[model samples]
Target: MKYYLLALWMWSGIHLANAQQAAVKVLTRAQENRILVRWGVDQPLEWQRANNSGFILKRITIKRNDQLLASPEKKQLVRLPIKPEPVESWMNLVQQDHYAAIIAQAIYGESFEVEDTGEQSEVSRIVNMVDEMHQRHSFGLFAADMSFQGSIKAGWGYIDTEVVKGEEYIYQVAVANDASIASGAGIAGLNDFEPLPEVVDFMALPDDRKVMFSWGIIPYKGIYSSYMIERATDGRNFTAISKTPIVDINDKTGNASTAMYFADTLSNNDQKYQYRIYGISAFGERGAISKPISTQGVASVSTPPRIHDYEFKTDGSVLLFWEYPKDAEAEIQSFEVAVAAKDQGDYKIVGKQLTVSKREFSYSKLEASNYFKVYAVGENNQKIASQSVLVQPIDSVPPAIPQGFKGQIDSLGVVQLSWKANAESDLLGYRIIRGQDKDEDFIELYDKAYPQTHFTDTLSLKLSNKKVYYRIAAEDFRHNISDFSEVLIIDKPDVIPPSAPVFSNYELANSAVQLEWINSTSDDLNLTVIKRRKKEDVNWETIASFTDLTTVFWDRKVEKNQVYEYLVMARDEANLWSNPNNSQITIAVFDWSAVEVIKDLQALVDREKRVISLFWRSVAKGETIAKIEIYKNKKGEAPTLWKVIHAGQNALNDVDLDINTEYQYYFVPTLHSNTPAKAISLTVQY
Candidate 1:
């Protein structure tokens, strides 16, 4: 009887509460995203009013339609609606005004509307949920006169009822600890039969990279069980990287399918792999899984040492050196060395087979004038060579190059000729000759000269157009001449850019507008990101700019529905904005849900100097009292922008004053918007 009465009270509250308020409203309004009953009130009722102060609205109650959904304290269900606001967030809420208001929600959520449930085994909890969703902000605990139990079948001492519902086992047993619960004034925690699973192979490594598993445990009896693999990249996200369990031992010995595996790669670059197993009896009972076993992967080097030096000594022996004071891979043997001089000189042999593991090397008698080099070789044979060091010995002179003489002359445009210089002082630089006409006898192109390398011509200038041609020759000094280089040419292109893109007018919605356009041309090399800003908008605006070659765009926000102007363009890698695609479109700007509340909807407000009045309305069934929050500030105290009016009661909506006085206001209906309860926000502005 106690439970029955409570159920009835809750039911009545749902059907009668909101219906009473719906009868008083006079205005019909729709917000851009909300539905309104009338000119939405802006001023929250003064909290001192009878409804908000000393008086408390009577707790509304309703009758339950069925025996289900009659629990008194369902913590889980209630916790859902009571969002877990952080302590600071909750404190901030209460501290905002004198106190925070608790707004009500729709009467039990809409009754369950579901498809047919065939005789097949299926549980229907929808009906139960709908009836229980009312005042969803809180959950209850007491199970009704009937057993509001979970799916578990038979228990240690519970008895089953008749008329079985498919696989569902209807069991009910009197509370053995009713006395214990009454004394504590709390519900009893569930107590079931014994034997939870036992840990078989439990083990954890010193590092946090630990794996948990169970094998050979009581609950797990080799009928082919399951396991998990957890890994951490930074040693923080210990994510379960495996979907299947590890297969360490086969149930059927040789017949066991290949076991899937898991390696938890840890931050230290070490991988700890664990294996565990579980099983279920043919009759449906389950055994504990065996404990887990862990193994680690081989250690590895994440970095290497820095080499800083290398030098050489005299005596034909090349010295090899390095700087790896901390290198653990030091058991290095045999030092290999090679030498070369000048950019064009071929590399020569110089290093000894071994350097007795010395950091410095000593080299002796050989071509003392040549450059020398030293490189270190690792056990793995990997090597690092030092920069070649050019050395001058006590006895050396410039190698010889046949000097004087040369050949040919021509004037493709200017002239052509040849010559030579000393072969080797470590032979470098070249010389070219030029003549006005064939065999005209020439002069050196460079007044200066060297050995080898000769010819040059004006063939390019004689070609006309934008093309310029020329040719080069190789020189080896000492009067040695090689073949000339291939002829060369360069040119400049002549092309132009295309026209600008064309865009459509702005389409309004919410606080933004939509804009679209056409690509500039066939070679629309790049689709520049779209840009926008309000008319007279100072800075360049960009709602969404994409670099990908996209021709279509939708600029989300334009200044409300007001007129906004925009230009569009395209550019190539050359960063050339195409001609501007211009458009001046005007859109309507209004908060639809912002109800234009008449000072006195139908009543009168008369004063000697002006008139101002209050309007009233009623709420509907299931509709909630959003905020009647009121706000007021002196003109100099606030910006022209919308400012929230805070100090007021939750139900207070209307405010009346002298019409000549400047005042701004609006109301926020509980309904954020007309879209849907869970959709768009509806604000009832006055």
Candidate 2:
């Protein structure tokens, strides 16, 4: 029986046992002379047992004159355990109170089961028996709660007429056979009873042939478990509209609802009605009634307007016609036409309010894209709108051609183009066309029309074309194309470097280096540059630049016997340099200082021996000499080293020679100094 009751409590979403741990739950209401106490068992089995075995009531004085009593005094309220009145004794009370009859039937009925037509399954039979028992237990408790007299008759209530003034007492109730007790405290004698607060924030909302009523529940949930609603056509006289008190069933479902609501249907529209509410406590006590709230029911506009036809005029205006039910027309107070620029955009009323007799309206203002709808506004201020219809003006003419089209290409091949925007109101955007040549067919640069006045494009620098062309055309909302604007020609950036100059010949004489080169063949060549650097130097210095077609340059700033590397490059108007590898040359300047060192050098030719003897003076003061070298060469030929002499020697003989040949002998001395040196030469005929 305990398990069955627990299952039933869980299924019904009742939190009686979980919220109150005691087997019996008690409540108390204080009065001037008497205190009313109510008690009930949380478990159905316990309640059934208590009903058979009766319950014991006890009281304790805890405080006097607001002062605590250190040792509480206890007393038994009844000498004998209190039990339910006999079934025969309830006959008179049952005739007076319906809830008393319900309690009587629940306790004294022969069988609590519903009459069954036919049943054979054991499971079905058991389930029906359980359901019947749960129904009896729940209905009996509910009935006892709704009637104070019923609770007393059921032995769940007590009236203490012996309460003392200015004293607080704690009451306890327990099943006669159980040790567990439920307790509650109340003050007696002192007027502790105050009027209950009226239903809070009570409101009524009138709708089409219906009214919804709601009131704050959280503020009064502890004071009232249910409510009774009353209504009246005239504000003076009111009567209960509900057959029974309305309980908030959502409390069992664990709904945290702040307000309780009740909806009532009206017999007719536009009729005034007044409503008020009364709160019913768990102890079957009705609280103070709420203030009356009044409103009138309004008729509903349910029929939507339907746009059957529309026409576009030559003046760029539109006319719309709609249909509505004749029977529903009486419910409508006015009509309206609405329009939006886009299909899903917010719509606004287009013209002044239209009467119910009007079925057509002319819309003078129009946009490129328009969605129109008709609405029927009822007397209740509710509006029902029709399906939106797309409307477009009749237009065959395109927008004017775009003008002032121009652009420039950067060195990175990025092109920026812009044009004057078309002034036409219906102009959607512009289309750009591009081509490598004026004669070839142009291709669209973008998949869709551009809505801006300016555009940018990147070109491949690897292409051979020097110039690209672009053209723009205006387009309207109806996809009409205008004539193409003037073709815009833009030059591609010059990224290719100029051809490098070639070194034709070079000479080393008079302690100076002279260089010659062939100029670059590119037509856009801007300058010819000459650069020179010592063979050991990491950086090159520019020595000369010529804007003209000059090919020869003499570098007189050179030192004797120094090896210098020269580069001749060409630069174009775009400031691009030529390749340095193809235009570089290395030369050694003549050592004129060596000629000063060996001013007295001489060479004698002996025709019989076929040899040339060379002599020179060495080492001046502050100069160190490493060795002397003899170089012999036939006239008009480059010299070759003949012999290396010791540092102490200043002369050498070249024996390998041809007779009658005008030979030149060079006397070069290797010096261990930072000063420049050159080889001195003398001509000898052998």
All candidates: TM-score? 0.21, 0.48
The C-alpha stretches of model 1 lying farther than 4 A from their native spots are: 1-266, 269-356, 362-396, 403-406, 409-426, 433-454, 459-686
Candidate with best lDDT: 2
Each model's lDDT: 0.35, 0.78
Question: lDDT per residue, candidate 2, 1-686, as tens digits?
Answer: 01111111111212264544446767777755788887776666656777888888889888887788999889989878889999889888987877777677767776554333342234234446565556566667767667878889889888889877768888877778666534334334345766667986999877888888888898886678678999988897998876667777677556758888888888887678889999987678888998899887887788999999998777778889999888888988899899997779999998546988888999988877789999998764688999999998877888888988989888799999988888987788999999999999999998877999999999998775667999999988889999998889998888888888999998866778778899998778999999999999999899999999999998999987688999999999889898988899999775645423455787777777766677777645566666667777788988888777766776667777665688777777667773445667788777
Write candidate 1's Cα lDDT for 163-232 as tens digits.
1111111111111222211110111111212333544454433223333222333234323233444444
Worst 10 residues of 2 by lDDT: 1-10
Candidate that scores best on TM-score: 2
